[model samples]
Structures are given as structure tokens and as C-alpha cells.
Target: MNLAIALTAARYGAATANYTEVQRLLKGPDTGRVCGVRCRDVLTGKEFDVRAKCVINATGPFTDSVRKMDDQEVPNICQPSAGVHIVMPGYYSPDNMGLLDPATSDGRVIFFLPWEKMTIAGTTDSPTDVTSHPIPTEEDINFILSEVRNYLGPDVEVRRGDVLAAWSGIRPLVTNPDSKDTQSLSRNHVVTISDSGLVTIAGGKWTTYRAMARDTIDAAVREHNLQAGSCRTMGLQLEGAQDWSPTLYIRLVQDYGLESEVAQHLASTYGDKAFEVAKIAQVTGKRWPIVGKRLVSEFPYIEAEVVYGVREYARTAVDVISRRTRLAFLNVQAADEALPRIVDIMGKELSWCEQKKKEELETAKTFLYYEMGYKVKTDQLTDRSEISLVPSDIERYKKRFRMFDKDKKGFITILDVQRVLQSVSVQMDENTLHEILNEVDLNKNGQVELNEFLQLMSAIQKGRVSGSRLAVLMKRAEENLRRQAIPVDRSGGGL
Candidate 1:
């Protein structure tokens, strides 16, 4: 219904039908009641007038602002509450299902919705000023982190780095005049008509939006004395509902080497429209394996998705990441890395200038960094990986690591270290390298920190002892590990 409504509004736009407006409702001359509405388009600075028999103020948190046009004295019964949602990678939850966290530390109900190959959790309610974009605070994030860890196993820790995107929305809830707690407020839709015949609708969830909209349209028709018939949405068939099945997915994996997870993501998100994405992929020869080995975890997204989002749904890099593909919500660094290419693609698609492209990239960065609580883009901070090293230890290792980590990304792949080590008189097998990394990498995130590098170097130095070397090394390493107060499991550590 939301998609249909948005498309319908686009079809009915006043301009060239190509431009969409974020409109502002203005107060016009009134005869003790609203006679007409003056609107200004926020995008193109265009102004227009709509003299309607009735007007519907369906704006969610801004409903009270709209009601002010009719009469500011109308008691603002709609209280806006901020709710935060955190998005992690798809591995956190089942691809086909979601989890309901019945309670949080704050006694708020949380939901883990597996949306578009990302796990969206939280919905902590806190009273906030009606701002343009409400942001989740550090307390909010830590609270969610603690709650998520409570449900996870002992070895699995949902750290701040795991969060890809975080967003907060203002829930327009109907409040009691004397109630102190807005969280206890009713979520039911509230509709009202002022003496000016302006109809205002507010406070409802998505499940009941159809009913809310039906009642709203009905109210508009009755108040305006229109000839429109009763709502036929009861029998409405949603778009892209044709011939969707698991067979299609199986065929995709069989024919295209797509991951079952990727297939599932597309099928659920686009329904029959999965064909369109696949068609693009096939034509461009850009098909990717569902578990993108390149990405470590299967990134069930393809280059073709960039094409689809531009032509079909998105206007900017932010839209592509946040809404169209859900990549930013799945991986923060990946999204940041992809942003420039996405902007370039979108710029060409939309015929954007250099300034517009820069603006789009900045917009995406702002949302990703601040709203989603992803990585701090400008600041160098610790706690990105599961491993920890004090500043002095980090600096010590970083200097030594720069010799091995050619790229200076603080991650030394086998090839990278081999390139440096071969320059010297050092050679090692892949298994040996893996064994060393596995031994020192405490968190098992496939990245070796400075401490790990020191440990590996020390192990290599201790290997010079001849006959008892194997037995002596093991015993000494174990004793050293005990002295250092470190624990080692199979492959050192497992996530």
C-alpha cells in the first residue's frame, strides 16, 4: 500500500511528472476555518495552491505541526517518541526468519527483523525533541549491545564494530493528558477533523496502516462529498507477486552460482522482480557467488544491484545503501568503500554534476557515521577488531607491522607478509603462516594485531633451538602463554 501510494502520488505530481517534491503545507486565508491550502515544494522552490473540500494531515511525527495550520489551539495529543533500530550483518539471524527480543535493559520490547540480508534490532523508546533526524546516543547503542549479548552464546560478542547501521524514528503515539510515560501510550491511530474540515490522521503501525488509510480516504470522501466508491484494497494484489518460488532460487544457484542466501534475499525483497536483477547480472556478466569469498562472508549483493537501484528505486548513494540494497546496514566499511563507486554510478544515472555527486556522498557518510553509529570516519580509534592492545604496545607493533603490512591497513595477508619476508631470507608454507596467525590472533577475526605479530616473531626466534625444538617450543610457549595470561583454543580462537 505504501509503495502504491507513493507511486500514485508521483504519477499525480504537478510538474513534469519526473520531479518529486518534499512539500510544506502553508496557512492560507481562513474564514474562521481553512478555505484552501498553500504548498511550497522543497526541492525546486515551486509554490502551488490546492483548494480542496478536505485536507488530510497524515504526516507521522509532524502531524501536530500540520494541525497548527487549522488551529494551533488544537491540543497536541500526538506525542512523538524516538525509537532506535540497529542493523548488523545477515549472519546474526536466520536468513528466512527473525527474532523477537521480548525485553531490553530498559523494559522496552525489541525486534530482530532479518531485513534484506541484514539483522535489524532494537526500538528503544526515549522522549526526544521533534527534530529532523533523531540520532541514537552512545547509551542507546551500549544498551542494545548489552541486550544483544545477553541472548547470544558466551563466545559470541556483538561489539560496536559489528553494527553496520543504526537509525532512529519518531513514533507518533497518542498520549493521555496526564500520563507521564509516553512508552505506555497507545499506538492506535487517532483521526480528527477541525472546524475547517481538515482531516488529520496519526499514530498507527504498518499492520493497521491499510485500515488507517481506508478510514482516512473514507473521511475525506464523506467530508468533501466526493463520489469515490468504498475502498477495494481488501482484494488488492501487491506488485511483483507472480510465480515466486524456491525453484527459481535453486535454478539461480545452479545456473549462476548464486548463494542460497543471496537467492533468498532477492526472492523475499523483490519477489518476481528478482528476474529483473538477475537479467541485469547476466547481461553485464557480473554474477557473484552468494557467499562472496572475496567479502569473507557471503555478501549476497551483486554489481548488477547498483544498476537496478539507479534505474528503479534510488536517487543517491544513501538511498542505495540505506534502503535499496541494505549494504550499509550490513557492513559499514564495505558501504564506505562502495560509496564512491555508487556515487559515480548514480551521478551518471541521474545526470548529476560534480557538486551534486559530492553532496550525495557526504549525505550518505553523515547518515552512515552518525545516525547508524557505524565507524567514525575521521577519527582513528581502537576497539574496531575484537583484539585489544594498549597504545604503547600498538605503536610498537604498528612500526614493526608497517614492514609486513605493505598497505598499512593493519591487516597482513599471507601474500603481503610473503612479499616482505621474501625480500629477506625467509620462506614459509601457507599452513605454517595460518598456524602462526591462528595461534596469536586471540579473537579469530582473521586480522593480526601488533601483539599477535610480536608473538609470531617471538615463536619464530624460539624455533632456532635444534633437537628438543618441537617439544621445548610447545612447553615454553604454553608456559609463556600462561605467564602472559592468555588462553588458546583450536585455531587459537573461534568467533
Candidate 2:
């Protein structure tokens, strides 16, 4: 939605300064009327001034911070509530269907919806400290999972291992500073003008963004007594909505020889501009497989989108993964694995040096693990694996291990692992099979014993096993089967 707004605004002659921050507001020498803002480019540390007839502060959660620039004594208007969401396997919800529980166990609203080929179960609303990047706490995760289970049948199990990614966002709920209960605060937008002639907007959500903007612009025009025409954005079509159809992907598949999944994804995401992305893929795919190839086998997101995202003002790996694409939100591990290729492609396009590329990867990893809650393997993996295995889990592992141990030698060979993976419909090559053996073979015997298999399953179940071929294979197999049951192609991340 943000991209659509930016694209539409650009086409209509709106100039956007990306990665720029406002230093201070400029005023007239005599009348003290607000004139412009002193701005600094965050990327280069260069400062500049933007002269404008009207200045509107619509920084959402940071509304108070920007308002403070106008007057330090201004009271706060933003009461931010942290809302956390988690993405589970697609089978958790039916395709194109969503469930909304009006009241959770604690009287808050929770929803389970299908999103980007995965199930999105969210949102715990509680007063939180204001921060740019909010982390999803374990307690919130468990609360969501537990609450969601109340709506599902006994046969349908919700496991922590099925969670692909989790994220937290601050809801910019506006209220008087005296209001202590965040839940009771209305989501309606509030528009106000300071004595300094600075217009500010706070609260609201994605569903009412258009109305919020209309109200904001109307207030700005009214407050400044500026000459402007009536708003025509109500009937305005977004940048790519014109001349787009559901069957537009057929043209891409026919002309570019792209896969059905890839075609559908591009068509839905880029709308009429999908052809431009497809052309890049067709032209550059021969030179680099990563350009047209899928980032993960289970999803249809190709590498060309990274190149296209860069062209659309994406400056970092996080922008491409988290914002430009939904890879980071849908699947953190896949996003992490695809990071190097994204940086490599972005480096070539943006003229980044080797050091810049390294810094980008490191910064992106810090975000994925610290901000997004992606787990990394450490020395505690053994202890976590042991703790995750209970009597029932051990028994279940024993029964499954016996099926592969047909010879009853109390151990399974690499071929047995390959067979087990194949039984789950995971295609494995010889190299991957050896890598799996190396991870599970604790004694370096080139074979996995019953105890080793138990420990491996425990770690896999607990999602503590990282950088292991077996863990990735098992996860892929489970997720692929779940997605195959659904009909829609959600790899594009957004509609």
C-alpha cells in the first residue's frame, strides 16, 4: 500500500526525499510564519532545506516527537500499542479465508488469516515503549498460539515449529495523555493544528488511510488558507491498477516462458508493471540463474524482484526483504538464506563496494534475528534438543525410526535418511544426503543411531537446529505439503 501511494504520488508530480530526516522547522524572519524544514539525508549525513507552502506531520507513532520540534512543551497525543503477528504454515487457515475472533481470552481482538501462502495469526495490543524496531516477545507468541488453539479442532495441531516468522508493529492509537487504557482508545484519526501553523495527523489504520489523508490535506489547506483545488484522490486509480486484469499473467507465461507460479506472482504484485519485471527476468535470466530463479523452491518469489525493488528506491537488504518483498515476514530462514544473493544483486545495481555489501548483510542479519526473532544455532542446541524431547516425543521418534531401521541393527544408514526424506516427498541429492549424515552422526561413524535420530528430531521440532540440511529438508517437506493443499499463489506477498 505504501508503494502504491508513493508510485501514484510520483506520477502526479510529488517529489519524495527518501532516507531524509527533518532537522528543524524554518520560520519567516518577521511574521514567524512556518516556511520550510531543514532536512538531513540519513544515508550520507548531508543536510539540506526543503521549502514548502505547507508542512504536515503524519509520522504516526512518532507524531509526538515531530510535534515536539514545533513546541517542546506540547503534550503527547500518541498512545502506541505494540501489535505482534506470527506466520504459520498455510494449512492453519483455508485459502482466501479468514477468521476473526471478536474477543480473545483477555477481551482483545485476535485474527487468523491466510497471507502470502501462510497463515497469519496476530495481534496482541498492549501499551509499549516507543521504538522504531519492536521485537516479538516469547510470551506474546505463546499467548497468540494458545488463543488460536481455542478456535481450532482437537485434530488440528498448532506447533511452534510451524511458525515461519513473527513481527511486531506499533499501532499509533491517539488519545489524551490522561487516558491510561489503550484498548478503550478509539482508532479514529485526529487532525490538529499548532499555534505555529504545523498540521499534524495521528491514529487510524490501513483500512482508513485514504480518508485519513483526505482529512489531513483538507485541514492543511484550511489552516494555511492556501489556494488549492478540491481533492480528486477518491476516484484516483493507483499507479498500476489501470489496464490490469486477473488473466494478465497468461501473457507473461506465454511470452516470457515463465512458470505459472512466477507469472501469477508477478502479475498480482506488479499489476500492469509485471511485464517490466518479466522482461528483466527474460533478458538477464540467461546470464544469472538467481535473476529469474525462485529464492526458495516452495515459493514463487524470484530474484528479479530484488533488482526491481532496488529500482524502486530500496537501499538496503532489509528494505527489499521486509518491505519491497514479504520474504522476511513470511519466512525468516528463507529470507536469511536469500540475503547474500539479494546483496550481490543490489550491490551491482547500486554501485556498492565490498565493504558496503558486507555491512548490509551484517545489518540485515541483526534485524532478522534481533528484531524479527529468527533463531540461530548455538552451543545450547544440545540442551534445547534434550529439553524438547518428552516421553511422548521420544516414543513417537522411536516408532518412526523403527520404520527406517528395517534391518533392526539399532541404527540407520545415509540411505535410510534419504528414504525417510523421500517418503515425505523431499527430493534429495547425494551431496545433501552426506551433509545430513555429517550433522546427525555424532560419533563420526557415518551412520545415525536411535539416540542420534531422537536428538535430531527433537532439535528439528524445537526449531533449534540451524544450518543443517536435514532440518531445512524436513521443514520444506512439511510446508510444501501444506501449501499444495491450498489453491492460491501468494508468493507475491501482497495484493
Q: Pick the candidate with the highest TM-score.
A: 2
| Candidate 2 residue-wise lDDT, 168-258, digit = tens | 9999989744456643677888888888888888899999988988998888888888898656679788977897999998888788777
Winning model by lDDT: 2
lDDT per residue for candidate 1 within 366-432, as digits (tens), equals 8887776664533222232223344564465456578777656656665655554444334555655
What TM-score goes with each of the models?
0.71, 0.77
What 10-residue stretch in candidate 1 is worst by lDDT?
377-386
List runs of model 1 lying over 4 Å from the truth: 1-5, 8-36, 89-104, 112-118, 176-184, 242-264, 278-297, 377-495
- For candidate 1, list the clashing residue pairs, or say none: 166-372, 259-290, 291-298, 292-298
User: For model 2, what is the alpha-carbon lDDT of residue 14?
Assistant: 97
